[model samples]
Target: MTKHHITLAGAAAIAIAVAAPVALAQDATVAKRVDKLEKEMRAVQRQVFPGGAPAFFEGEIAPDATPGQVVKSNSPVADLTARVDALESQLRALTGQTEQNAFQLRELEKQFAAYKAEMDKRVPPAAAGEPAATPASLPVVAAPRPAAPTPAPAATATPPKKPATPPAASAGKPDAARLALVKKVEIPSSGNEQQDAYDYGFRLWSAKLYPEAQAQLKTVVAKWPKSSQASYAQNLLGRAYLDDGKPSLAAVAFYNNYKDRPDGPRAPHSLMYMGIALDKLGRKADACKAFRELDEVYGTKAPQDVRTDAAAAKAKAGC
Candidate 1:
């Protein structure tokens, strides 16, 4: 019985010695595969997140674990599947961000198109060879009526010889002394811009400074074409030309006032002046027409001065 026991112990020891190496080799192979898998996972993390990788990627769930305890999955396939899910989630997030960026770009394009259309409406086309107008100097709005005639710069300004008499009818060019006087004329700034401009022009006209008056009146019309003073400035401009003996230019100025602002305070005066200008131009028939039209349009509403002037002009022209 003792010998049999010894033989069995020897057999058991040899069997254990041979099985140890095989088990150790299997464990080493499994550890090497795990190491290779870990290396591949780290490489994927670096490629996916160049900034940095997330922590604790192997054990995703530990619902019943205490502090410092994790329930790790033994299967490499489960870990790889979890990583694939993370990659898909990141791709979905990137796709959503791209869609949002495309939507914002479309909105910006729409806004730019609307702004361009608005600009086109505000600015008028420049004439050939003319520089484009700056936005600061552009007109506030489009004018409803045709522009008035532009007067020649031939007429000049000077003090009249007498209160009742006008400056001498000549080339009407300003000498150095007259220009110096014009420079001395005070342009008021009493907070009423249109009124102040008109007042300055009126003073120039009253002083028999026809050229300066014409220029100032034209500026008033250009700067504030919608102001109440526009009518007054336009009518006075015609008289300035008439006093300077540019009867043809005067006729055009007066006719424009009457046609453009028929309901203006100075419309009747403009019509009467227009007839006088036409008479000076030796168009008796047209002068007669102007005088007759004034009586027909504003028979009773005409001012006393306009009425008296019109009647005298009619008699002189045999209308």
Candidate 2:
């Protein structure tokens, strides 16, 4: 029994020795594979993040880690997901800004349309009967109405003598007389009548009756110098002269309107017109100076049309 036990122990020792080398060889192969895998992972990390690994990975491990232990982190995937989220957020912001810009552009177009309509109502058509060579300083004259014939004696001589009465005023009354009366009438202060009178002058301007418009607008300015409509009338008068091809006169009128009421509703319009008139008069330097002054003085307070028109005019004048 003692001899049999010794033989079993020797067998057990030889088997243990054989198993130890195989286990050590397997461990060495596994360690080499882990080192190769770590090198490949580090190469991928360098390619992915040229600047460096993110701060979250700082000081977390030695250059080499022990084999048979797993290193696990969701950081790379989490970082990719966070970057995608940020890109989506930025895209959404840009889309919102684009929508807002489109809305503002639509609103600006609406405002421009309304302003153009108002300007159309104020501008006049060219006169038909105006001479081709009419002087710019002179106002355009409306065609004269035909005269009515005097009554002749009745064939029966004294058959019946009717009472003498003034002829009823007709719709075909002479334009000259109507225009004279328009110039003579005084503009009342703050009433419907005042508004009507101003509207009538505006109608004349729209009809291309420049002489009539000038006369009526001048009367409104003279009679209601302190009224709100005075600035409007003055500005219209300047435009009338400008459209009539009298640039010097238009410049003077526009300057007067701006000088008299720099804060008036029409002041910026007057300045813009003044610049146009100066340009028409071949005084480009003065015109550019006027445009520069307009921006310096009004900044954004000027109407959008005035601002746009000023920019266009400035470009045209090469300012």
Candidate 3:
């Protein structure tokens, strides 16, 4: 009877050992699956929130859970399910925010396009093949005639005859010589044909038609070299080249204006713009020299606007 009892015990021990390995294998498989799920959750969190996963969903110990005590479930499946639920909630929130940002970006792009269209309308392109109008020539006046000599009064005449009123003055006409001189030296008229031509070019410039404006202004400058508007046309021609991204050409135009008419009203402005064009060309040293010359020559004589612009340009160039 004692042998029989020992045999039964040995057989039970072998069975128990076999069952223990099977249970351990099942547990290992579950642990591996749980690890995989956790890794997937971390990847999702990284995509959703680049800064970091939220503290609440990061598997931190609950405030009420005591130190050294496990708050998670003993079953790995249950723990994984809970983590997945938290990740799903975070993903929903992140997706909504991303959509909102995308919508805002699209709206901003539309606004920018509309603004550009409106600006384009304000500066319409010049019509093709339209000829520029010619200015009318100034009228010439003839030189005054010499006055007739008065005959000597008779000795017997009791009273000198009153001096006869000049025929030209009596007719209310000005002296021809004086009129001619006045017309030659008169200030430019704003309503004259020359001014109108310049205005047409100025309108082209306002519309950002740099090529057309440059051509028109050149014609005005060449045709009316002695006109008061010559300085203005030359200065604006330089600006056209500058605005059209031809800084080298703009520098030449500006320099010419300054050199040709240093004391003209637009000379200081031309010098200031020359500095700006040189700076754009990466010739900062030449730009600084231009600015210095402007200040040295014009000083307080420069217009307030020109001086202000020069100062700003100088500061930007570190001059």
Candidate 4:
């Protein structure tokens, strides 16, 4: 009987040892599932709140509720069910929040697009090639005409006499007053037409009448493009603009002179002045390029005065 009792005890001990390993394996499987669920929760949080997870979200999953903690559950299934329920509830909340944020952003974009359309209608775009008309460019409103005097009685009538005033200049014509100003500045004529036109422009430029000089020089270039005076006129036109505080226009004029008449007598002068104009327009790098080009293109052929000025300019520009 004692042997039998001892044998029974040994069998029971073996059974207990086998059960322990199975229970441990089940616990390990549950832990892995819980870890996977936690990782999925974190990924959802990142997608929902791109900036960062909120404070409440960071602390939402209680440490004591984790699978690592000893939960008083009747079975592993019950523990897994509780954990899945919690994750599903949080996931649903995050999904709703993401949808709400996307809706708000789309609505904002629509509102902005509508407002832009309204503004565009109110302020029409400018026509191609034409600048928007400013207040100064608007046409003047004419004064209302007075009612004609009641016609005189036939017995007392006298024929209407013409007014003794000079006829007004026609519309779209050059102003007579401006022409009179041009005529006032006298320039002695040369036998050569090209020379005479350039001399008149030069005289106007010397007198500090930059607008008139620009117009006159343009005329000289237009009328005698093949003449020797064309080079001088183009260079002087650039100088006129430069002296009038229009460095931008001056730079263009100088570039045209050199590009169109490279072999002309004043080509080097134009290139030098182009550099100075670019410098005045606050373009140091472009100025350096111009100076470098002047050296490369003209070398010793450039006038002494131009080379000296270019050297000074390069130093000033730190080139």
Q: Which is the leading candidate under TM-score? A: 1
Which candidate model has the greater TM-score, 1 or 4? Answer: 1
Residue 284 shift from truth in candidate 3, angstroms: 0.7
Instruction: Kindly report which residue pairs in candidate 2 clash with one another.
Output: none
* Count of clashes in candidate 1: 0
Q: Which stretches of candidate 1 lie above 4 Å from their native place?
A: 1-175
Predicted model with the maximum lDDT: 4
C-alpha lDDT of candidate 3 relative to the true structure: 0.58
Where is model 2 more than 4 Å wrong at Cα?
1-191
- For 115-233, candidate 3 gives per-residue lDDT tens digits of 43642353232221111110112111111221222222111111112211111222255466533432232122233445644554564555555555676667667778776677777
lDDT of 2 at 76: 48
Tens-digit lDDT string for candidate 1 (53-133): 565254222232222111144655445445555654665576566668779989977975664354234222221001111
Q: What TM-score should be assigned to candidate 4? A: 0.44
Cα displacement (Å) at residue 166, model 1: 19
Residue 131 alpha-carbon offset, candidate 1, angstroms: 29
Q: Model 1, poorest ten-residue lDDT window?
A: 127-136
- Residue 145, candidate 4: Cα error in Å is 56
Cα error, candidate 1, residue 144 (Å): 26
